[model samples]
Target: MKRFLTLLIAVVIALSAMSTFAENAKTLKIGTDAEPIGFDPHTTPAHASIRIMHQMYETLVELDDDLNVIPELAVSWEQPDDLTYIFKLREGVKFHSGRELKAADVKYSFERILNPDLGALGSTPSYAGNIDKVEVIDDYTVKITLSKITAPFLASMSSIYCSIVDSEAVEANGDLLRADGGTGPYTLGEWVPDNRVTVNRFEDYWLDGYNFENIEFYVISDSSARMSALRTGEVDIIIGDSAMLSIAEAAPNVDVHKIRTRDYITICLNLNMPEFSDVRVRQAISLALDRQEIIDLACDGQAEVSGFAPASMGHWAVDVNEHPLYKQDIEKAKELMKEAGFENGFSVTCTVGLNDHIRNSGTVIQQQLAQIGIDVTVQNKENAQYVDDWKNHDFEMMICQNGAGSDPNRAVAFFFGTGANANIAEYSNARVDELCELGAGTTDVDKRREYYTEAINIILDECPNVTFASPYNYYYASSSLEGYSPTLNRPLDVRNVTKE
Candidate 1:
């Protein structure tokens, strides 16, 4: 009888061990607002898809906690001159399909960006403005040569546009779709376009192992729906505006994270038009509104009043007071409008995206501008249509919001340069362009700052954009999750995240 009892105890212990192991092997379910239109790192660089792809693809460089570029695929790099950079790729890294990553692949990936047939797939001119050539030095080394001295070279590499790709996979797939061909910690398992995407951890990943076994992304675009999903445990996390913070704070088993982002929402004025060419008119529009009131009503006080773009994340933020563009004065605004012959007010169409936060803010601005005698007709369109219209410069004014590039130079260049993607304002000042060019070509920090400061003054004086507020990156995570680190400007990196 004693022998029989010992055998029974052993069986019980074995079952308990198996149960523990099963509990530990939990899969995390993450939901986001729509998979980006394309999965190609070059095509849909800024879309949510790249964030998901980052798990499946490794970049040559990755940003650290302080927002500085650090080596990821490239073990080390050196600048032979002001315009040339040589990177030594890390050896032994393999793609998800068991092929080795090579320097030739890096060259191919970059060259793909410059292809004219790819449309906007080309390198973001704002960030890659100075890059002239990419030369493969050897099997594991490549040299990046710029046309001019670029201070933000490392920071520019941190962009999704520069993320490394597997050449074999690109050749096979023809375009970046939902597939397993990257060198990241996760591998694409399934993707349902516009609805959901799923990634499973790559067992043969070259870097540290991912915490979660699988990540499932569900696109929940509606703010209310996203909040409901988070509260009901249908999803593990939801990223949205400050308006969702109240609901998030009250929800059980939910944690709300608010990080200051480099994103800013402003009014993009068409400077190419004669009416908006007057700087006083631009300044008047800026000063006429009560920005703080708008922040409270529209964003629930979850935004910071912006001046000349937001500061870089973490320790690199320049002193806010040192920048003059952030100053607010209503009387001065009215005076400038009168000086520009718009004291009697004029009818203008303000185009806005239907994104909840943007639409809500546009509504608030419509009321505020009305108080100043500006007859603003608000036009709300779907996000895609709004982007297309804005890109083509087809609107008189637009409710524009953009996340700044990793570097200040890149950020300023995109918005203020002569013909940049976000330069919807169409306002051109020779001085501003010169400053941007100078800043882009200078490697010295102080010299770059001088150029940036001069450019900021020009933008403020010109009033291309009626600067409003810089919103926080707000998201809710399940209480059971751990090790999720959020960056200010970039999308959430889920490879290191794990559930408790």
Candidate 2:
């Protein structure tokens, strides 16, 4: 009897310990569609990678819920002149590696990003492309000198790609993604390729209210798989489009949130390619596309047909109705094709990413163009390969998404400006380039609008790329998850999030 009692006591103690662990160690599991390429904020440009950077690193500034610029590592900033800006850093902030945050760290981080030998992939339109030099004013302040007056510099500082890293950590760990050490809310704990990433909450995080002990980012590329994970209680949150949101809403104890974004889908035409060299051919292709039909079929009416630029770009985007090319006129398309010496239309391959909406848009475009006697052969590839092919200019045409920028200058520069790495279409117009420079250099809203409008009009007239639609993003969270508000730009900020 004594032996049995002792054994029972041991079992009870173990059970109690397990319960305590369960209560103390809360984890929020999220089903992400794709895995990020790396954790390096300076180089990784893709959306998945940017989301990870937001958690693992801290930027000099951040955006509030309204997309307004707010303080993060830097308490405040002031423009000393058109070409120079100064930042006052926050003191007592601790990096994950235990080094105190200082102005020199900021200077080194910016310098590393701007280094040509470093070859940062995502810095062109924002950080390295705009800023010329960084000067440490003191232990608590830094001054940035720009080659020219960049109007979007403040907002760009809030971008995830501009997140600051510890110089000591980077030197010790080498320039590797997984070697992340920053003054952020979390640290990468585990990464299983094509499976999941686990992050542990930093005990010394500067920001408060990050109550969850762990966050698990599970890879579920398939839409159904992601929803299934959420339904089966394997994941507490999943981000999807409108169709997936409908299914998630029907599930028990799930809440759906809508995010407005400037992200747009475009059929990027290779202007240097044989069939697309003629401007009439490109215009015909745009007229042949029924943007509304594509949006309705592919996005289930969850998207709006945008003009050549995203409507979310506020004053910069020309109204869709103002552009005659946006209207699908099959007869006019045929006339233009005939004028361009291809009345019967020519077959072209359109490469697309593995995402459902992109592939579906390609299919819809294929069917719609067939009505105008154009044969569009759809070619689908994985996301990474597609991005590489795009950068290499290896396709006749391609369907892809363009990320939103802090200003019209960024959006215009990304797709149409010369020397922009994101200009996959190989499009360049001297006038458009001049306007982009003008827009970037000016702080006057009216003057900037004029420059952007002219550039947008020129691109639309030239038909370098067909901007079809902007799809609304949807995210589903378990009812117990709180403080998760969707935004136009930042999607993965879970700092203040708590799972009840």
Candidate 3:
């Protein structure tokens, strides 16, 4: 009896120890869709790159769940004039390198990115392209002047591309990546190329909510692989699609999360191409596509068919059914094609990235355009090559996704503005350019939206591109994980996450 009693006590102690160990686990693992190109905040327009950089760096401002402008690094901001804006930094905030964040640092960061030599991606018309200069007023005060008054300037400040860097560290390492040059909740840790990047909690982080000791973002290119990782307990969370959602819903150990995103998909036509140069041809292609069917076939009915902007943007978005340009008419498309001197058909290649949904959309586009007497061959490329081709304007037709913004200026200005870097279609319109300028130069929300509205209608008429579907992003996590609230801007912030 004594031996049996001792054995029972030992078993209880072992169980308790195991339970404590499980509760104390502080590492949060995520399986992401793509590997980040680099940790340099200013270099890439890829969301994957920004998503990982967000863990270690922060912007001056951020949008809240309601898409309201809120302060992040800056305590507050004021616009003294139409072109000049001033910000007051948060006192006591320290960079991961142990130096206090100051106005000088902000000035240096902005100047470095703005330098044409640096070739920062955000230097293009879509992002910080409006900024004229940065001035350091004092240790805590910074002033920024814009060449022109623009609404996107405010939204641009919230982008990760404009993250303030530790000038001292950059001087030491020559770049921000692998240098721990930020004031955010985490510090850059190990980065194994094509595998994973780890961010450790900055012990001196200024905020209170971040609790995870380490957050690891593992790149699993294949969706099925990511789903398998989440299911088998290799990864705690995963960014997934409808197929993953269906599988995860049935998995007892997984918890599914749905984020209403402003991410919209578009099929861009190279206006430089001879066949796609005609407005009638472009408009016909737009009419040929059935946005609803694309959403259903590609997204598994987890998206809204839209025009230019997604329905998630509230009043800023145009309804597909109501918009004449978005209305599907196979007969109209054929007639337009005939009028454009392509009576029988034309063959064009549609390029796609590595993402499954995007690839599926390319395939669906190929099938839909066949009705309009157009033959499309879908070509898939590795993510890196795809980004390269996209940036160089190398494809005839490409299916891509863009992050949606609350402000109409950001939603349209970056992609539709003539000479804008994000304008993959190389679409040019004098009236649209004028509307973008008028919209951006104004502070009034309603008036700015009216400008965008007019510009959008003109863009539709011209048919430079087709903004089709806004799909809901689905993520799945381990049921035991807690405090994993994420937004469209920072989808994978696990700072407050804890193993329950």
Q: Clash number for every model?
A: 1, 0, 0
lDDT of 3 by residue, 164-194 (tens): 8888887888776556688888888898989
- Best model number under lDDT: 3
lDDT of each: 0.73, 0.81, 0.83
Which stretches of candidate 1 lie above 4 Å from their native place?
A: 1-25, 45-47, 116-126, 171-174, 177-181, 312-335, 489-491
In candidate 2, the residue pairs with backbone N, CA or C atoms under 3 Å apart (3 or more residues apart, or in different chains) clash, namely: none
Question: Which 10 residues in a row give candidate 1 its minimum summed lDDT?
Answer: 313-322
Better of 1 and 2 by TM-score: 2
Give per-residue lDDT, candidate 2, residue 388. Answer: 68
Better of 2 and 3 by lDDT: 3
Q: Between prediction 1 and prediction 2, which has the larger lDDT?
A: 2
Model 1 residue 14 lDDT score: 100
* lDDT tens digits, residue span 325-432, model 1: 445566676677788787877888889873555777888888877755678889987555675687578998788767665566666777777766567787677888
All-Cα superposition RMSD per candidate: 4.5, 2.8, 2.6
Q: What is the C-alpha local distance difference test score of candidate 3?
A: 0.83
